[model samples]
Target: MMREVLTFRGKATAGTEFALGVAAAVVVLLLWEVVARLEFVAPQFLPPPSKVIAALWTMATTQHLLWHSLISSLRVWVAFLIAAAMAIPIGILMSSYRIVGAPLEPMIDFIRYLPVPALVPLSIIWFGVGEETKIFLLWLGTFFQLVLLVADDMRRVPHEYVEIAFTLGARPRQVMTDVALRSMGPNLVDNLRITLGWCWTYLVIAEIVAADSGLGFVIWSARRYVKTPEVMAGVVVIGLIGLITDQLLRALHRRMFRYL
Candidate 1:
């Protein structure tokens, strides 16, 4: 007889999963609150959840926090899309042809290792420290790594699959378009999702140089005034925004790869 997947994990509903995730977050917050209340850590250094919420509420009502958050989110998405557009085609080209991959891989890797922050001056000179510089910073952080990720995913497709396609009289173009790209679609989506997180990581760095708006700007400004609660609030906003986008991507990935 075949065994049934009847364990707790196997039997979990979406509601149960959501509840568990919420519970885990609640537990962490409770612990942090306890520490803050007991004065285990200084309030100035580690504000409690209530204080952070109050700070965030003040910003929302008085300082246009939503607009700044939206600007930051737009920057992230624009940069991520640009990076994906540049990286995916090149990744496919490199993975498809050893002649192409061998020569260019070294140059790309070399540039990737040069820290993004080091490029801030160059980007400011080139793009004039406006939106372009910020977006470029976000792109630089994500593109090189994403190209490698997509290429690696493509290369991971089994040679046997390609051979099987060829045996069935599939043309090179058809094999690449129908088989290779399709096989890698789910993985590519996952790659985009992962790299989106990387794009968010660059936000503070991007906005710090000449920014007047963005969550990063808010956090940086709060820090200047020693507004620990406001800084924490801004950090929490970034985390929540990231969490939402991450989950959205994961949901889209699951929808795209349901057969898997």
Candidate 2:
């Protein structure tokens, strides 16, 4: 009977927490609706939540804007995945070999600071204002940061782990694969979560440089036509998508690292 009471109390606490979160969201939405309807702020500049939702519904029915936004997001995801594939291995290799890392360090630092959007003209020149150029820009934006992150994580692994592996008659490859890599896994996953946020900003910047279609393009094109509601809708979509992706990554991390 005591145990049952404790369980009931625990559930009640969780329910209270959930209720508070829902109430907070509702209050914010109500405030926004009230302010917009009262014209306390310009509706054109700050459309109410209802207007944004209406715009989304109308756009969904009339145009493939959402489809285009998804395509743009997919491009960013694919490019980021490719960048990670290339960066992680190279980072591991660099961390394992001091000499290799030394020579590349300066060059990597230089390029990492360079603004990716500044390469738009050159990218178009090379890849010709197509999807390839956009993807390449996204890759360039994400690759250096990931490389640095992975390499840094690899370096932070305790030397004792490597020593233990060696004492157990493990080869260098075995030490890296079994000990160093596993140690770095959590940090790498965390960096990926952080990078997912960066990818949203990079995708918009990339699309702005050269794109006939995309969420960024939608926002940009809508601004030109003075479609403030559409622009607000696009902004909302971007935020929702970014939040969804972040949640998914968080879930993946929790699932994979449950033991940790």
lDDT of each: 0.90, 0.86
Candidate 1, run of 10 with poorest lDDT: 1-10
lDDT tens readout by residue for model 2, 128-240: 97899989988998899889888899999999999999999999998988999888888899898887678788888878778888898888888898788899998888988
Local error of candidate 1 at 104, Å? 1.1
Measured over all alpha carbons after superposition, the RMSD of each candidate to the real structure, in angstroms, is 3.6, 4.2
Which sections of candidate 2 miss by over 4 Å?
Answer: 1-17
Off by over 4 Å in 1: 1-18
The lowest-lDDT stretch of 10 consecutive residues in candidate 2 is 1-10
